[model samples]
Target: MGDLSLVRALGRGNIPVAVTTSERQSKVGFSRYCVAVVPTPSWVDDPEAALAAVIAWSEQQREPPVLFYQGDHDLLAASRGRERMAGHLRCVLPPAELVENLVDKQRFAAFAERRKLPVPLTRTLCRGK
Candidate 1:
């Protein structure tokens, strides 16, 4: 959802957009605004290669592009690899500690509750239930 919204917005400004996805079959990557669609390694299966791909692409660009994080995985990856990536691109991601804290489900839930924020009820389901 965020990906499409961002892509369209960039399109409006006539910024060249490129995206990495599990495959070229990704509908979001096919938007008319998109100029390049690079299929990426699965984040779960090979995070290192995925990170490398992003860096490789950015380095090839004559002018560094503004990078956006699509989700927690992307955010965390960018945060962790910021130093390496920032050399070639303007990578935007929250601090690594902040990303780590927010991505931890239990910690996030507790923080939300402490701040009197609404939190959905969660239960740990047992195996074979």
Candidate 2:
């Protein structure tokens, strides 16, 4: 859903977009705004492989493309590999610590509390809890 919306929004501005999805059945690949649909390794299973796929695909492009991500996994994979993708891609990524804090609920809750952000208290439950 997010990919579809993003592609449509970009398309309105005549911006070309390419998508990388772990699922071959993703409908975003069929959107007219999508110029290319690349299959990437699942970020949930192996982030390193996903990042590698992103870099490899980016390298094959004629020019460095802006990296836009709607999913947390995509964001993390991109953030973790920002350095490696420097010349091959263009992206705005948060610092590693910030990315970690945002992606991890426990860390985000703690961070929010520390910053006096109005976030509800959060708890972590282990197995058998």
Candidate 3:
């Protein structure tokens, strides 16, 4: 859903966009809205396999496409496989380590503290407190 809006916005700015998904269900139908729809692999259990599938699929494209990974798992997997996927497509995501930190609340909090950035005070909840 968010990708569709992003693509529409990018289209408005005259930027080419391609949408990729693993699901058979179509969230956004192609009707002069975007460039193309590419189907990658689903990462329900094995994320590495999904990343490899996307990398292979991307490599077959005539032109290198700008890649935008939506899910965290996808982002992580893509980052891990970035070297192999670099020439095929450009991914707009941070490094794997950065993504890992972002996904982990504890790590993010520690990072903020180390960088002297403000972080919300959080408390652990206990049963029958």
- Number of the top-ranking candidate, with lDDT as the measure: 2
What is the C-alpha lDDT profile of model 3 across 1-129, one tens digit per residue? 126777787788998666666766656546356666666666556777776766666677787777776777777777777887778878677767888888777788877778888778756568999
Residue 46, model 3, lDDT: 72
Which lDDT tens digits does candidate 2 get at residues 1-129? Answer: 138889999988999988888898889999999999878878778887877887889888899888887878878888888888899888888798999899988899999989999987788889987
Which regions of candidate 1 fall more than 4 Å away from where they truly are? 110-129
> Which residue pairs show collisions in model 1?
none
For each candidate, give its TM-score against the true structure: 0.79, 0.90, 0.76
The runs of at least 3 residues in candidate 3 whose Cα sits more than 4 Å from the true structure, single-residue gaps closed, are: 124-129
**How many times do residue backbones clash in model 1?**
0
Q: Is candidate 1 or candidate 3 better by lDDT?
A: 1
TM-score of 3: 0.76
Off by over 4 Å in 2: 126-129
> What C-alpha lDDT, on a 0 to 100 scale, does residue 11 get in candidate 1?
90
Local lDDT at 108 for model 2: 95
**What's model 1's lDDT at 73?**
76
